[model samples]
Target: MPNSAAAMSKTGMVTKIHTRIRADPFSAHYELVGKELGRGKFAVVKKCIEKATGKQYAAKFQRKRRKGADCRMDILNEIAVLELAKANPYVVALHEVYETSTEIILVLECAAGGEIFDQCVADNDEAFTEKDVMRLARQILSGVAFLHRNNVVHLDLKPQNILLTSARPLGDIRIVDFGLSRRMDSITEVREILGTPEYVAPEILNYEPISTATDMWSIGVLTYVMLTGESPFLGDDKQVTFLNISQVNVDYSPDTFDGISSLAVDFIKSLLVKNPRKRATAEECLSHPWLNPHPHPHPHRHARSASSLDEPETSQSESEPDSPVPSPDLDDLIGSYLTCPGQGELKAGRDAFSFGEPPFPARPEIQQEVIC
Candidate 1:
């Protein structure tokens, strides 16, 4: 039965022979080759090629079961969001999906440029100019707007999830990873604390109702990291980081904003507000002067010179713990941040995985009822 093919009743149609059938359905169409692009707790993304067309793709091979039961719903939800937002230029495309008895393979668009965080770190000398940030931010907002229009909320919007099409100067970006995404009605509330500790919104930490504004808050954090290499709410430890986010303890000191433009600062301020209702919507962000500055012959001048700003120094004693902290132990902290009174801690032992070239970070699950 595993390799059998069913025939449909035909009134006046001819059946073709050579109908492909294989014990492993994935191998029948695509050939997985080359080194693994990335790895996670339950999945490995490898480079794959279409047998017929020789087209390349990043195939994410995920196990159907995590502990015992099938955990395919998360993957299915991700697929749904991708299908809804496929037309958006900034969102990564899901080409095809193949499932076997034990695994599900998702063929995704090959992002050659890699993660935006890596690009930002690598380009320390030739830092991104204001125009570059503006263009990238605009494209990201366009993607967010499209997702919002489709009633999709990308709860986890971080630099690691943003990829470039190419390594060229200011190449177009593609937003990947929907592990924490959810589809909801505009008026309904999503109540789950499921996002990276540093970039997650305060509303999420407080276990308050969530909406598209949650994504907007993360966008603000992304903007901060994009402009300044340092994380705005990063604390000495994970718990401290969560407290910083809950308290909205953002450091917009002169040191951090020394060379940054006031308009750009205003744009970030608009999104990072503690009150989710007060945050700027993605559509509104597109019109912000920071993103749509007056055109000038020397547009680069609008962004303060990167050379004038001193890189913020971090002492190991400030961030790292005296003793090594186990990676899995952080799950407890995440559970504390995510769990509310009625909702128990989200099922643990689930590896937070992304669909990038290499697995970046495991995303936390947020439980919410879908309105549609």
Candidate 2:
């Protein structure tokens, strides 16, 4: 895949998958450097390394299609969301998008620490401090701020979608997997309902107008989920869940909700407002006292770290070193999706599927920088 704008024009979309990202090559151009980080219905994400940079990445290889796979549109919709969200630090960076005749390869940023869900769940009885919650809240606000600025609404915003760059001291935070993302205009609001079963706002369930505030509701749900492990509203059935949302059947049991701050709880109440018109903005959320309870100890002395200022990182590894991974035959995966000239080429976000080309040399000036 060439970086030339010509290639972009040829494909209609500016982003195209390079040759190095293909499923099969003579040798492992991009080695399977680590074990599978996670798996989804359509793809399996593996921790990988570019032989040239030795930098780690999470490679999500789309599983080969089987008969009766219902969410093909959803799978490609995720790709479109990734396309719109490329170059944003908070959003998972999509480096390369590859296609075999049968499967899609998405080379994405790897947040080594995994989902923030683990952090939220770590202290069983112990609750997250306001400071800790604020830190994550600010990062999430900044990320969602970017998406909102770009007019993309993340229908699904939860702890599971939030990931950490490092484990112990914690590191940069990123929002990943926008399979349910929707773009909206200033005056427009979506009526169609879409979102995770638990995090969805009341308005969404009622088929009300969706806006950036819809994301705000999800964020509120996320904040509550982070402070406490359980969801605000859970029911035995999907219909029941939707009913709870529509009816705002939120129970703030003091005994059940042990250790959560009243201010945190109040902030969630404000964000989870059934009417999207009244919901808080990302900026407003950042300004909430719950998110910034105390002033910085040394505001002037706290210059941002150089590393922190850099573009988001797409990979992370342990302080020691990761065990080597045995390379596997990508051909087995690629063979199914390889090109057939007579047939239509696979299309993803205006990029046409192409292979059998040479890898583009790394650009010195434009060194790959992690955005999260």
Candidate 3:
């Protein structure tokens, strides 16, 4: 079963609902062995070891309210989605859940590898090759297809939201943060101005109807970032970036695609079509020639001594929630940002997670998708 986190219905509805969760304190069964792995506006991810098995996991503590706003249902929405996709492997799994006076903790599988954003910016020898990209693309599409099939759209798909099970020699991807996700339905037409600027679909900016094609626009941007290490539509600022995307002003210069395949370029072209109807679906993307299962030298890098950026004191990982004893209050830890290396860098930080901005806030849902 695939899994995800955030507050929303699988059918694309953003409404409040009750969740079945353990109301006991999270510290009763799991010990906070290390530090907070990551944090955002309304949540913090911490490293916890289940007392029962000593198996490690990442516990996300999401605030029930933001700035004195009651939003407990937001947390429940995420749990609901994770619960819905429990069987899909590509999406991260929610091992367990717990509730407290102020927060809900989601125990998840700690991903040993970090966010693919690292690989996108990785240098020289560690750079991802076509084969590596293909492998990742398939996994991403498989997960997306799973979500789409369920009528859910991860409206904010980006490299930071895509995590790897293992970084070295690369491994399967685990899609995270469904706060912005919505379920698509034949009966309802979803429309909203949401998502990270660079990865956002044009229709969103134009205030047009939203659909699965919205996510496809992001996949195109993500693919370009993976192949070229540069954001195709990133402009001087948010407005310029919006302009670039609105006009489909992508740069497919020789320098950008120098060593890349023409098929890869064509794949991106197909997805970046200004018209959402013209963009490829997740299943179609899986069948694109660029992703054809062709043999090539393994591009997954071997493990090496990590640099400072590769290691952080408290990286986010997957874990299930359980409490074994009295735990420290998270007043300081919960809101403070983590430089977790084991889990990955807190990709966006507070600015990214602020309900105010939309590079889709740095998240512990650290999220970009909370459309509330």
Best by lDDT: 3
For model 2, the stretches where C-alpha displacement exceeds 4 angstroms are 1-28, 63-80, 83-87, 125-127, 186-189, 294-372
Tens-digit lDDT string for candidate 1 (1-372)? 132332211210111212222246888888888776665555667777889999877777767676465666655556666766777667777777777887767777776656566544445465566656767787788788888876678877877677776655446667876766777754555575566666778776665776889999999988887787667777655666666776788878878777889998899999999898999998778667787554334323212222211222111110000001112222322211111223211111112221111111232333332211
What TM-score does prediction 2 earn?
Answer: 0.69
Better of 2 and 3 by lDDT: 3
Q: Candidate 1: deviation at residue 6, Å? A: 26
Q: How accurate is candidate 3 locally (lDDT)?
A: 0.66
Ranking by lDDT: 3, 1, 2
Cα error of candidate 2 at position 98, Å: 1.3
lDDT of 3 at 176: 79
- Residue 251 in model 2: lDDT: 69
Colliding pairs, model 1: 352-362, 352-363
Query: What TM-score does each of the candidates earn?
Result: 0.73, 0.69, 0.78
Report the C-alpha lDDT of model 2 over 78-102, residue by residue, as the tens digit.
5555666565556677766666766
Task: Give the Cα lDDT of each candidate.
Answer: 0.61, 0.56, 0.66
Which of the numbered candidates is closest to the native, going by highest TM-score?
A: 3
**Better lDDT candidate (1, 2):** 1
